[model samples]
Target: MTATPRPSESGLPIEPVYGPDALDGWDPDEKLGEPGSYPFTRGVYPSMYTGRPWTMRQYAGFGTAVESNARYKQLIANGTMGLSVAFDLPTQMGHDSDAPIAHGEVGKVGVAIDSIDDMRVLFDGIPLDQVSTSMTINAPGALLLLLYQLVGEEQGVPAEKLTGTIQNDVLKEYIARGTYIFPPKPSLRLIADIFKYCKAEIPKWNTISISGYHMAEAGASPAQEIAFTLADGIEYVRTAVAAGMDVDDFAPRLSFFFVARTTILEEVAKFRAARRIWARVMREEFGAENPKSLMLRFHTQTAGVQLTAQQPEVNLVRVAVQGLAAVLGGTQSLHTNSFDEAIALPTDKSARLALRTQQVLAYETDVTATVDPFAGSYVVEKMTDDVEAAALELMAKVEEMGGAVDAIERGFQKGEIERSAYRIAQETDSGERVVVGVNRYTIDVEEPYEPLRVDPAIEAQQAARLAELRADRDQAAVDAALAALKKAAEGADNVLHPMRDALKARATVGEVCNALREVWGTYVPTDAF
Candidate 1:
């Protein structure tokens, strides 16, 4: 029998070669618009990277705030255009390092930031107005953002000048990641409050980064990734509009996050299809008039799940290829995962090399010399149409089930992604997937490598700091502020104002989250979903 044709990661069939008929009935006029125009399939901007390269952001954080701060300074010195922070479990989960629940986990995955004091140290010497930061925090995203603003005020930086993004996508947490704090109803309400607060207090801040990155890492194929992510984006827009806000007010500030895997062509098609779908949804469905409101501007990170730990150094090549795919796909910003990440936290040398990967893509490659380089290619155009059709079909299913939150309650997205993950696992086990260092190429005596390790003493030190903070601050003021925050959470008032007051009064991240938890309660997954 003839050899079977290989299939794409999304289970779509790939032809041996594509020609003119691949896009036989495609209409360029309606499908592909000029760059910076409607249906931004070409790109969201006219010049694209021809004017300036995409922002090179390095995601780094580990151990204490002081240690993580040093890494940030070093990255800036090494030519990083932006900073993306990674917080430890305790901070992301809204617990002080000293909490009984936080024991043995402080500073294990990322940096432990308990209060404004830690936030201040996290950006001590960095200029808030000059540098754009992206914090990877979900359920406790609001608290960390307020603390950052507090630090900016301490540094004399105006709120409007403070530019950054907070990964405030809690819906994904409920679906894939397990960091959700409140139930769906309360969580969406809190997100609406964030949109309102950012509009008034922090106009430059990205209110939420509706993410497909986590879902992809959890094994979602390209179609599932964008379908679920854009579905959530639509839900957020609907919630904001229902709360009496215009689409243009917050949509312009809205952004997205996605993963760029080694499959360059398909990833490029995915990005283009995503822009096209979002543009159509905003214009036709929502009647959004502003061009900015219709644009699907997103940041991309190289796929962390695709890296292999067997031959850790080989990951550098994987990251470089993945980063190239992101650039070719027209991402606004990018974070290149270091080669050592599959093993442990990136060593200083590996982190610099990761930044260098982007630098090479920018200065060394001619790929940035043009915009939408593969716009008219028959194969890419056909693949874009195919992915678009697949994603739209999934999106329609989500809509039929009453949108993202309802589908999520029914465990639709989660179950779909799990099936995809299982497929990949099975293929790997059968050796149908050729992972070079894993099954195909075997070497008996591999060289030893020492991975970077976080100091276990960090937990005790953070606990001591929390104790000292409690001793020095006025407990009554903090208590009253927390009580007010709880009252606001219990009522219809915007809670961030009181939450900010509590943070400004030296309230711990856990305390602020606890106040809301008392009112909204926490999210516990049920088997029925």
Candidate 2:
């Protein structure tokens, strides 16, 4: 290893070091107030992790429903606290495995969930009531959530008792991930319906996980990611409120998902700033009276972008550092990236090791004993303030463009993200960013590590199952459910109720979506460039 070059000091930057004097203008007692207090900058919970360590949720799902179910049980036995399900591109975009557009992608990246039958097999022997689940679905989130509700009913789990999060943030899908199915206004209307439905039926469930992970992965700065994500959350609240839902009812169930990147201190401060900003928005801006409404509970995943394709083992260290930053910043749950993630989905061994990393942190490190350990540190505090101010400024710009939806529609958000992404890529290409095995200390030859490979047989098996599902269920019932669902979409009824009924009648994801498409029509994105 050679000595690293000194980082640029000419730019306006935080001082290298500071003492008590660094907080001269800042009130330590007011800012660092107790955890679980009003304006919870320290944490949403007073005991922090002393009462319970953050839920260790490793995102896992691949191949067929049976395969994903077995893996979920395996993770639980290995001490995972929650199950985070990842769906294949087909399911994510509202196509069934057998759909023509889904041909080559079924069961490749994540689990293939087509109908209620697949949902049943996915939760086979696993009780939905006892274990919390998180689904990473966006455009077709309502369909998936309906399937989940049906699965819970099948397992004798009442709707009110079901607990979990659904990443139903379709607006971000359009701006960042490109998984949208409808235009912005209709998409937002569907989300409002879900918010209203969940508040009335599923009290413990999170209707939407306003996510910033995709934004970070799309090359937004930490400040932009935090700001834009919270801004979206506020927009959702406004949408729901405009639909006649109370802020306290839906707000408490709203949660956030963020990425913890390799910028250790920046990531930590970003989380802290996120909490403070969200709390203020809920109370001061939204006029929420409930403390839970102000609590910015979130699930953190280690930055997948930080993982390197070369010498992927280095990702283990990167993920560990990012995971630790998430814990220190007071995340309620975390997903550590597997060492082999850069190359592909993790092999079983690598995934287990990633889960173990969180276990070691919880048991070996005494860091959990103290809440917000760096809350008052000059560097952390200053960074938090800097990020909060910068994010608010960016948000004001977004507001001037008529808020997040308008910014996204005009391609402003995507353009900003592209600019940041290009700058970072330029830095990496110029060797200014040292990505260990990739840029610096380049390993000329690398040993190959086993990666998770999806078998072509899995797709065949899934298609067969889809055929069997169609054969076993009554076609009349399926047709009726779809008709009802379409009618609901065309009317003022909440779509989740009709969708859940359709799932119970064994309607496939594709069927439910197609029916709604008849009423709502499809979205055609204007040239964003």
**Candidate 1 lDDT tens digits, 1-529:** 5557568877787777888888888899889989889899999999999999998877789999999999889878866648889999999999999999999889988999999999999999998998989999989888999999999999999998989999999999987878888898889998999999999989999989999999999999999999999999999999999999999999999999999999998999999999999999999999899999999999999999999888888999999999998998899999999998888888889988998899999999999999999999987898899899999999999999999999998899999998899989999989999887888896776778899989999999999999999999999999999999999998999988999999999999988988889999998876442
Question: Over the full model, what C-alpha lDDT does candidate 1 score relative to the true structure?
Answer: 0.92
With a 3 Å backbone cut-off (N, CA, C), the pairs that clash in candidate 1 are: none
lDDT of 2: 0.85
Clashes of each: 0, 0
lDDT, each prediction: 0.92, 0.85
Q: In model 2, which range of ten residues has the least summed lDDT?
A: 3-12
lDDT of 1 at 503: 98
TM-score of each prediction: 0.98, 0.95
Q: Candidate 1: where is the Cα deviation over 4 Å?
A: 1-4, 527-529
Candidate 2 — which pairs collide? none
Candidate 2 lDDT, 201-270, residue by residue in tens = 8878888999999988998888888878987887899899999988998898899999988777777788
